[model samples]
Structure formats: C-alpha cells, structure tokens
Target: MALVKEGDTITIDAHARSLHLHISDEKLAHRRANCQPLPPRYIRGVLVKYTKLVSSSSLSALTDFNLF
Candidate 1:
C-alpha cells in the first residue's frame, strides 16, 4: 500500500479499476522514514485488555485466552 499524506490528492478511476496518489516517490519515502507509531489510546482496563488480546477481524477477532 502507498502512503498518502494529508492534503495529498488522489484519483480513482472506476473504469480502469485503479487508484492513484498524487505524491512523489521521494516524498512518500521521506514520510515513511519519519513516521512514528502512535501511542496506545487506552491506558488501562477492559479496552486495553481487549486491544492486547483481540485478533484481526479477518481472523474473527478471536481473543487469545492464553495471553491473559
């Protein structure tokens, strides 16, 4: 997947079944290199626990009970 910066323009062609991001490769690479992981939103409690244990939705969001 390509990184799209804020305010970047995107073009979607339904007939062509394609999407394009109007960003230079160099700029995208720079953004990727400087990107930082966001801090977890939940500090504590059930939501925190859920985040730690839940699997991706494609995997049915199954909680790994063994992790608890």
Candidate 2:
C-alpha cells in the first residue's frame, strides 16, 4: 500500500478506498487530553493494540522497537 498523506489519517489507494484511516497514538493522546469523548480506558487499550499489531507486522522499519 502506498502512503499518500501523513497526518491523523493516512490515505492508501484512495482511488478505491476513501474512508481508510488509521489513527496514530499521538492523535489519540491529543483526543484524550482534549476530552473528545473517547474514554481514557479505551485509549490505553488502543495504544496496547496498536503496539501489538505494529510489532507483529512488516512495518518494523518504521520503528526502532526490538519486537520479534
């Protein structure tokens, strides 16, 4: 998938998928700080889930994690 944009949402293959968006941890933290309705507990869960998913994916180059 080719990344077309960099922000709260990354557009990949926009020609076929327009609603494809991935919320980053920084964005989630901002939402939690501003009290954007997403619960704090859920925010923690999302962080954990994101970490697990990324660590297991081929996107390891994007991060310096030693995740195996």
Candidate 3:
C-alpha cells in the first residue's frame, strides 16, 4: 500500500498491542519530532494499514500541516 493520507485511520503495533492513530498531519509529528531522540520509520510488516481519502469539501477551515 501507499503512504497514509489525512483522515486515514491507522492501527499500528505498539509493542504488545495495536494502537490506533489518525494520520492527519502531513509528515506525522511523532515521526518527525526533532526533540525526540529517535524518529519513526517505515517498518516492514509493522506499519500495516491502508489510506482513506478525506473529504475536503465538507471542511471549510481545516488548516494545512507545516511539512517543512
């Protein structure tokens, strides 16, 4: 599958159980936080989920994520 997009509900494995997270951020904050010692990466068989297209037509004031 391709990379996750906004409004896509993802269930990722967090140690013992699967943790559900919504990927609305453009670059995924937890994965891109510079203050954190380690950054998140795409792990084979670990990041298992599909992307769901978000309906932007309904949202009138949704702020875009800063990817830079």
Model 1, range 6-68, lDDT digits (tens) per residue?
Answer: 788999999999988888888878989988878889999999999888898998798864655
Candidate 3 per-residue lDDT over residues 1-68, each given as its tens digit: 13444667888786867666666564566456544443445434434221122224565323443422
User: Per model, how many backbone clashes are there?
Assistant: 0, 0, 0
The per-residue C-alpha lDDT of model 1 at residue 16 equals: 100
lDDT of 2 at 43: 48
Q: Output the number of the lDDT-best candidate.
A: 1
The best-first sequence of candidates by lDDT reads: 1, 2, 3
Question: So what's the TM-score on candidate 2?
Answer: 0.22
- What clash pairs does model 1 have? none
Q: State every prediction's TM-score relative to the real structure.
A: 0.71, 0.22, 0.20
Report, for every candidate in turn, its global Cα lDDT versus the true structure: 0.83, 0.54, 0.49
How would you order the candidates by TM-score, starting with the best? 1, 2, 3
Q: Higher-TM-score candidate among 1 and 2?
A: 1
For model 2, residues 7-33, the per-residue Cα lDDT tens digits are: 445556867865554867675566556
- Where is model 1 more than 4 Å wrong at Cα? 13-19, 64-68
Which pairs clash in the backbone of model 2? Answer: none
